[model samples]
Target: MADKVVVFDFGGVLIDWNPDYLYRQLITDDTERRRFLTEVCSLDWITQQDGGQPIAKGTAELVARFPEHESLIRAFYERWHEMIRGVLEEGVALVDKLEAAGVPLFGLTNWSDETFPWAWERFSVLRRFRDVVVSGRVKLAKPDPAIYAEMYSRIQQQVPGVAPQDIVFIDDNVKNTRAASALGWHGVHHTSAGATEVQLRELGLAFA
Candidate 1:
């Protein structure tokens, strides 16, 4: 933990971000809500940049994607930002602990730049992160070999002697963790705060 880099997934791991919060704000009709979530928005598109698209574009795309829900797509877009806004206290504490311990932490999230600032404003915890690699900025999402490649390459150039394998990745998506692990980097699939804390402790990353 002295000089190792720790990569974290933002949405589920740190801040209890949920898409339903936004849906409730926009669609009030029970039947319309059911149709929008299950059939239109797929209920969860936070990591997919459903939160990033502007109200108009997001709505248009929604309509295009789900013709039957075209009429309500614009309304869905209006509430998209509000959906992915909450932050988990436990997760933010973990980040603070890891940061205080001198771990070179980075945020690797699949998000678009469009909605990042909006969410950022709502969640101040993002201020703690400096090395953020967003899909919208890099144009490469997680589980893509290239995203991890670029991450390692950039870190190596910025901090000499840093190896890809020296980094530990924690993500909620098993596939994303697997991809990082395949690159010789250690990875943990985080499903809960307790599980992630265990990994941090095991990796000598837990803070006192």
Candidate 2:
């Protein structure tokens, strides 16, 4: 129960996310939609990408997995980012409280490169925190040990003597939290900002 570093899951825990949202918006044609989802945009594929695969390689392979549907894959990706728009206010409120408290917060997220820019514009919130470890940029995603290791390394390099126990990571995904714990980092399964405040309170971090 040490008070120190906090890692956060950017997508579901802090920002609102739903796969169906993008799928619904990006896919309208019936046959093309079916082929795009099953062959090109499968959750299993996303999971593999989360496991720390190359986005270009993973995407290329996925597109190649269906010889007949490569053109549809191109169109599907072209419209993907427009589906994601903003953050959930409840999450941002807690983050704002933590920022106001001067607690060091870092994001450990598994998201594509495109989604965040739009979200940042909509929420006007990314600059408030430090170290946004996005899978797209880092080429490593969550639930994979590499992302956590890289994040810890970067934090330590930036601010010397900041240990794993000093950081508390919050995310909604169980696998992600568990993986981070295995790496000796403190992580939490985020439910709501109200509840998260209780956990951070113990860590001497501000939460609202």
Candidate 3:
């Protein structure tokens, strides 16, 4: 078996980030909080920012649409740090094991360029990556083939003759994993660290 090159998706996989962490503090009522998150500041809305839209523009446009929830919408970016709880320890452990075994590692995350700096400072695990492809910085996000292609190019530069089939990509989102798989990568859908470890072992990556 060829030694595997692993690519990680940071947000839900390695980092525990949820908008509810901040929204819970601001909106006391659970129902109202759910409604606001679904209606006003949804994933689709933030994804545009992740795809390189300026925070100011995304916030202003959102505020304009939901004028009554102005404070809340603005807080999404202004108080964005609160949204992060911390690193997923188990996931980080997996990364540690991989590195110790001399596996090549890279990151492909759909994160805002402006907010990524905050995460970089807080999470040491992120620095563990040999290189990271930030969607906001590159103007391409996950589930988009272009971003995966870009990552593949970078991987080739580092690993020389590494083929796509020899790369294993772990992501919390099924769509992202599927996209990578479609392009000849070994995509592992990460739900939990234990489950991911099982999948990795099955793929002949016995890093334990």
**Can you write out model 1's per-residue Cα lDDT over 1-208, one digit (the tens) per residue?**
4456888888888767665676665678878777767766663453355234444565566678778666556654465556565788888888878888777777788777776677777777776765777776776778889888878876776678987767888898899999999999889899887888887678765576
- Mind giving the per-residue lDDT tens digits that candidate 3 earns over 89-156? 99999999999999999999999999999999989999998889999999998889999999999999
**Cand. 2 Cα-lDDT:** 0.71
For residue 41, give model 2's deviation from the true position in Å. Answer: 2.2
Error of 2 at 125 (Å): 1.3
Clashes of each: 2, 8, 0
**Which portions of model 1 miss their true places by more than 4 Å?**
1-3, 24-39, 43-58
Local distance difference test scores for all models: 0.73, 0.71, 0.94
Clashes in candidate 1: how many? Answer: 2
TM-score (all chains, Cα) for each model: 0.81, 0.77, 0.96
Query: For model 2, how does the per-residue alpha-carbon lDDT over 94-208 read when each residue is reduced to its tens digit?
Result: 8777777666778777876654566667656665667778776677777778888898988887668887777788988878888887877767778787777787786666443
List the pairs of residues colliding in candidate 3: none
Q: Judged by lDDT relative to the true structure, which candidate is superior, 1 or 3?
A: 3
How close to the true structure is residue 162 of candidate 2, measured as C-alpha lDDT?
A: 82
